[model samples]
Target: MRLLIVEDEADLASALRTGLSHAGYAVDTAATGAEALAKFGVHAYDLVVLDLNLPDGDGLLLCRRIRSVSGVRILMLTARASLADRVRGLDHGADDYLVKPFALAELLARLRALLRRDGDTGEPVLRAGGLELDPASGEVSRGGVPITLTRKEFGVLRYLMSRPGRLIPAEELLEHVWDEFANPFTETVRVTVGTLRRKVSSPGGTPPIETVIGRGYRLVDR
Candidate 1:
């Protein structure tokens, strides 16, 4: 999944971007609320790590603006720890809140919790046909055999698995699986899907993924 970290602290933003990237998320950062909104307008993010104290605008207002536009998950990460602050943040549209000086592990757990609520099921392990994916463990397997995939491949499979048998356009995949740095017109999705197909296919077995000419790709529910 992709995330937007809106933090004015250079050190914190850098740390968050690095840490979240290592945790298998496409991450981007904005040091001000204006920059965050600009980036948000240009990219599709699964979640937002918003700080309440932005240089250009209040994070609560920004959160409201984002909430007004989309239902994307929001997690307010800030130094505000009072009960009123928490309630106000949630009232402003944050799905979750994490105080500063928090543990990355805890933040990840919270983020996963938010994503789980938005996903197809709350089982933690996603299953479709013979494929099994554990988002928490970052593991994918087929028919009891473990399958390793690149970050992009894993993200693509995760998305496809979420809505099995539904056609997904390349633009949708690029928007969600890749960060803002990806070129929208590039053939990256097709190439990544090609490589992913080879890795997940069983010996002498038909591939689980299906492609439609002039359309998009689908993960057969099978």
Candidate 2:
């Protein structure tokens, strides 16, 4: 998923961007509330890691602005640890809150929880045909056999499974699965999908992902 980190602290923001990117997420950073909003307006982020204090304006107001435009998940990150502060953050449309000096592992866990709650499907494990995907554990299996996938491959499959039986264009996959730094015209999506198809297909079984002429790829029902 994609994330926007709105933290003025250069070091912390850089660290978060690097860590989340390594953890298989497309992440972007903004130092000011204005910058954050500009990026938010352009990108459909799955989540926003917001700070209460900003160089341009209060983060709480920014949170309200973000809520006004989209229902994207918001995780408030600030040094304010008081109960009242947490409550206020939540009241300002933040879906989750995390205090400063928090462990990266804990932040990741909380992010996952928020995303799971946002998944309107209400199902933790996604199933299509003989393929099963557990988003929480990042696990996938086919016909009861384990299958290992690269991070991008997993992201692509997850996006496809999120809307089963629908034709997904290559541009859509590139927009959602890849970060802003990725080239829009790159053949990376095609290459990744090809590899994913081979890995998920069984020797004597029908392929689950099918390509359409000049359209895109679709995940077929088993």
Candidate 3:
């Protein structure tokens, strides 16, 4: 596995490079955020170990920028142990966080966890026909235009997009979106879908989210 270590401290960076290399990963170290981004642009990395205190900018900013162009998993490392800092890092797009003065074993374990998560999971982006749903940004678009959708609307759309051309019952959608707390017989699913269709489909046209009478819905091929 190829990994990028974005850290400013030369000694710490070298130690990580040596440790990860010995652990059977191809390691690349960058001393600054700029260098990290430049390396990322050229070479695809399996995971990124980003230090929060960088010489150029905050690691959270770098994480967001990387997520904008690539879905690479990020593990944040920093001395800030406050709950707020950790929550902020995660909210910004970090998959995991490790506080400074951490053991090498824990770091390797976290790195392995990130890699395993990435490999086992299929593509996060849901694309059916011309419609696309990005779970990270909760953004949907058809062709190229942005399609604004509420949280529930995006959840319904994402679930449908996950299984294209398959009839998904309202029960399944409710369970998937609302964690089985929603009553499928209610008109909640239909109403949300109606709003979603209006936002995603072109005006005066058939929506991509097709309703199957007495069965469920399907995202049919155009």
1 versus 2: better lDDT goes to: 1
Q: What would the per-residue lDDT of candidate 3 be over residues 1-222, giving only the tens digit for each residue?
A: 457899999999989988776554557889898999998986657788999899988888998999889888899989989999999999988899999999998888787667658542136666785787665445778888998776677667766776778898876666445521345568998898888777888778788888888788888757
- Per-candidate TM equals 0.95, 0.92, 0.54
Candidate 1 ranges with C-alpha deviation above 4 Å: 120-122
C-alpha lDDT score of every prediction, in listed order: 0.89, 0.88, 0.78
Predicted candidate 1 versus true structure: per-residue lDDT over 1-222, tens digit per residue: 889999999998999988887777888899998999899998888899999998888999999999999999999999999999999999999999999889999999999999988873346898985799998888999989999898889889988888888999988888888887888888999999999988988899889898887789899867
Q: Please give me the total number of clashing residue pairs in predicted model 2.
A: 0
Please tell me which predicted candidate would have the highest TM-score against the true structure: 1
How far out, in Å, is residue 173 in model 2?
1.6
Task: Return the TM-score for candidate 3, rounded to 2 decimals.
Answer: 0.54
**Which stretches in model 3 have alpha-carbon errors above 4 Å?**
120-222
* Top lDDT hit: 1
lDDT of 2 by residue, 1-222 (tens): 788999999999999998887676778889999999888988778899999999888999999999998999999999999999999999999999999999999998898888888772237889985689887678899978999999899888888887788899998888777887889877899999999999999998888999996899999976
Worst 10 residues of 1 by lDDT: 115-124
